[model samples]
Target: MDNTVEQVNVLCIKWGDKYGSDYVNTLYSMVSRNLSRPFRFICLTDEAGGIRDEVEVKDIPKIGFKDFDEKHPWAKAHGWLKLTCFANPLYDLQGPTLFLDLDIVIVGSLDKFFEPEGDFLVIKEWDKSDATGNTSVFRFEAGAHEDALDYLKQDANKATADVRNEQEYITQFVDRQNKLKYWPEQWCRSFKRHCLRPFPFSFFQQPRIPEGAKVIIFHGKPHPDDALRGRSGKWYRKVLPTGWIAEYWR
Candidate 1:
């Protein structure tokens, strides 16, 4: 690795027991293999006991909501805590920072993500026809979007009531400033939407990775682990064991 090359930041957050240290460790391994650019892998979490030493561990930045609690009913359902990543002066992290959900699998090169021209870029929601974006994969300057967090802090109640989730809130805020942009549709793909076969076909076929996809997001159900073992969360959806996940998910 060339020390003179500019390094970018890759960030992920883990708060609850829904995901374990293995998720963070494997994510770091996968990112290390896929990204050609000199990069720093950072994990913001409440517990860092089992995380690998190579990853720069940091406490999750606080959003300062008066009644904020990760285990609270509303906060548990919505990803409000992710807003903390937008806090101004985010723990000395600077330049283009890419935030990825812990459940995604990186299958292709990541160098091109930084080559795009955009202040804020996210995955356009595959299910919605509106301008809303999926925050599973997004990139922005480390401290560029503090206003979005500030707005949420001003009134947590109204903010939670107005939007369905944190991604929608941030999308609406950035879009209001005319700075919102999306990655190419083929880049970040949803496993449920793009990979799994439909209904009857799913019973016989194993899931396949889409062409030109860099990251495969395991959003709602059938996470990477489940797919690797052929466990479909739904009774109606039959998913066969996918061997390819082992090839890239680490």
Candidate 2:
């Protein structure tokens, strides 16, 4: 490790009572094990009671649109709290920042994420043709994309009027300006789409990490722990024994 190297910020958010401290703690461990570059790990959350000591903790930043007249359910419905990372002058820390969802599993090197040159980089939506971002793992220079949140403050109704969630709104807005870029196709793989076998085959084959995939995203059902036990929430999509998750998801 270079003592004089600049420290990169790795950010995650946890709010409400859905995810316990274990989720955040595990994420930090995985990140530490995978990243070799100097980094400052931070978690912006409402309840930081159970997080480990090594990780820096901060309260979730307040957004500008708190009691808007329009029915903007980004907070209540979708995981909109993530947008706070784009807030200009975010918490005093500055430089390249990489944001990861608490539910993802890090199985490969993360140093390349911060190495790539781009205005804004995110996981391309697995199932979209119109340049939608998944936001599971995204990176941007601090204070570079304040416009994402500024639009919501200007007119929450008009900003999110047609979009269903925050990712769609943010991706569409930035993509239009040519600031949005996507990670290499194989870098970020979805557990449901890439790991789990097809419907019938899924019943017998265990979920495995795709070659060259650095991170596995558990977006909806069957979390990292769920995969360890070979439990696929649905009957159609089966998960057999997979030893890799047990070895990696510590």
Candidate 3:
């Protein structure tokens, strides 16, 4: 390890009303509790009213597409707004940055995330066989990925016409240049895949953290709050009240 102290950054983005202030507040708390290194907690948000002062709030970076409309089907289809993180110069603060989605629950030490060697790091899709990556938890140098933004701006409509989503676009863009990489197989995990008990066992048992998991992602429905209340977002999936969530979710 280097003798010099470095400023690690933990970043989160909140765009629309889909997530409220509580989500950002709790995520900040969870990160503050789990990370051992000295770090700056940042929230890129449109509304920063309810976030804690400890978290540095900045306006969400724009990708220079003034016509970008979130309500448009193509833009909404993928998390297109998240592409703003690729803005070159990215608001003064620049260094190794770990971008986390607001819905994740951190369960283990995060110091290791900054220790990895890579120009970019993300969770490999839990379902795909290809090199596609999930953007839920990704790491990259502050200004390194600006080319992805530039590529999107060249022809906004045409760029997304054949693509699945932003992650696909980013992975393909970086993969072409051989800069794409994934987190260690076990560090980042899915709640339903690794934590939830299956079938009849699910009825009898409560969700438990997987061994060695550092982060748990709640991708679709059954958010952390939903899990705490035992309200499975889907009618088919049963989510019993997970009291353990309260312990870590803050």
Candidate 4:
């Protein structure tokens, strides 16, 4: 790996009460332990009460979209918060950044995500049939993709009318420019892939972390907490050592 950059910056977003501040605090420790380089861990959030003192906390930027202005029902869909990650390239931030979802638990080192060369980078969603990024983890220069926000603002509803989440809209927007790139295969894995023991096999099985995966994304239910409990509370008793998730919840 080239490792040419002076330092890498990490960013995560937290809004509303879904995820508690401990997720932010633990993530800071996890990332710090895994990446052995100079790095900044920034949390873009509305609440900063419980996060550890060592972590840098920043307010979630208002990306100037009307949807976010009025506090409407679909404010999140306006792509406002996700838009902040692109600000670095435009100089809103000082260096390269890897944006993460607060719900994720860092299981390994994130060094490889920084080494790849590209205008934009993200993890390939395992469920995607073609070139779709899961967006649970992604990296890019700030402000490099201002047009994505601009385009969404121009046709706010049209841009997000059908998509289910930010990853879909953002990846498609970046992909159109032919500049978006992805991390090496298997560097990012899905929690369902790496942590959960499937049904039928659930009675006796455990999640196998992929060999090269640096992060495992828990997109829907059966989050890290649920995985650690050895119980999704549904039909499958997907048991794994709860120790992994206990570390994150710390």
Candidate 5:
């Protein structure tokens, strides 16, 4: 490595009322504990009212959509398209950006993600088992993936209309690029893979955070609160390990 001590920037985006400032604060705390470097904790948000003290807060950079015309998820103002800072560089998004969804916890040191690998690095979807990117957490250079935004700009409504999720369109764009890369196999993982059990075995076993997993992502229903309580978000108790949430939240 040219510089063993890498200067990494951690980025997150928040908009509207669906989620509160607590998500950002918790993320900041978790990241602070996990990553050791000249790190920058940036939150691209509409309003910075309740954000933490150390974070560098900035307004959600302009995409020229005027906020009202953003896509469905972003128009919801909380989905995720708003967090795709690498798209246009409007927010002064710079350097190598590690875009993390706020609903996750940083359980281990994140130095592995900084190892140079690809132009754009994302977690390979565990379920799809293909190039499908699990965008819950990913990294890229700021304003680097302009084509991803160009696709939307060319056909704003159509680009995001058919797909039910934002990551779908973004993944499609990345796959076509031929420059997209993925994280080292073990650094990023799905919570279910390392945490919740699928069935009866779950009763006897706890989720096994992989040997070198850097980030455990709670993609769908089970959130940090749910995971913390040792329960999935569903009504019936599955093979979720008890006290996992207490371990992180405490």
Candidate 6:
């Protein structure tokens, strides 16, 4: 280990029981294998028990979503809590911070993510025609966009009404500042949209990993584990057991 080498931050937030510690541990393991450069794997969570010792665990930041909590208790489930990653002083972590959702599976080298020239980078929503970017895998300098969080804290009611989710809110704010950039289309792929075979073909064939995909975003339904076992999470859609997921998802 060279002390002089610069270490970037790899961050993930785990607030609820929806995902367990195994998800964090597996992500850390995947990152360790694929990222050549030195990095800090940090998990911001409400409960850190059972997480691997190698990961630095920090409590999830509180952005004071009192109004939202009262009116829309469902807001928390909508990823509003992720805005805390933009807090001005994110517990001493700084520079080129990559925020990854717990559900994502890294399959390629992540060194290229920090090489991109942009103040903020995200995955363009494949399903949307608008400028909205998926929040599954996004990068920004730590402490650079506290305003996004402030906007939500100041008026949770108005913020929630304006945007459908946290990703939309952050995307609009960064785009307004002319700092939003998207990764190449092939780098961060949506498993549901890009991998799963369409309709009838999906029933028999296993999902294929897209070429050049560094991170596979399991945004909804049939997460990495579910896909591995051939559980599509829906009756109509069929996902055959994919053995390759075990190759990289560990």
Against the true structure, whose lDDT is highest?
1
TM-score (all chains, Cα) for each model: 0.95, 0.93, 0.94, 0.88, 0.85, 0.94
**Candidate 6 TM-score over all chains jointly:** 0.94
For residue 14, what is the lDDT in candidate 3? 85
> For model 6, how many clashes?
0
Angstrom error of the Cα, residue 124, model 6: value is 0.1
Model 1: CA > 4 A from native: 1-4, 69-73
Q: Count steric clashes of candidate 5.
A: 3
- For model 4, the stretches where C-alpha displacement exceeds 4 angstroms are 1-5, 77-80, 88-92, 236-241, 247-250
**Tens-digit lDDT track for model 3 on 130-220?**
7789899999998888888777779877776766888877876788889988999889989888888999888878998988899999998
Off by over 4 Å in 5: 1-6, 66-74, 77-80, 236-241
Better of 1 and 5 by lDDT: 1
List, residue by residue over 144-219, the lDDT tens digit for candidate 2.
Answer: 7888888888987788788888789888889999889999999999999999888677766777799999999998
Rank order (by lDDT, best first)? 1, 6, 2, 3, 4, 5
Tell me the whole-model lDDT of each prediction, alpha carbons only: 0.88, 0.85, 0.84, 0.73, 0.72, 0.87
For candidate 1, report its TM-score. Answer: 0.95
What pairs collide in candidate 5? 74-77, 195-207, 228-245
User: Model 3 shows how many backbone clashes?
Assistant: 0
1-250 per-residue lDDT for model 1 (tens digits): 7667678999999987889999999999999999988999999888998999999999987666654434466664567677778877889999999999999999999888888888899999988787789999999999999988777778777765767998988987899899999999999998989999898888888898999999999998899999999998988778899899999999
For lDDT, candidate 4 versus 6, the one ahead is: 6
Least accurate stretch of 10 residues (summed lDDT) in model 2? Answer: 67-76
Could you tell which candidate, 2 or 6, scores higher by lDDT?
6
Give candidate 6 misplaced runs (Cα > 4 Å). Answer: 1-4, 64-72
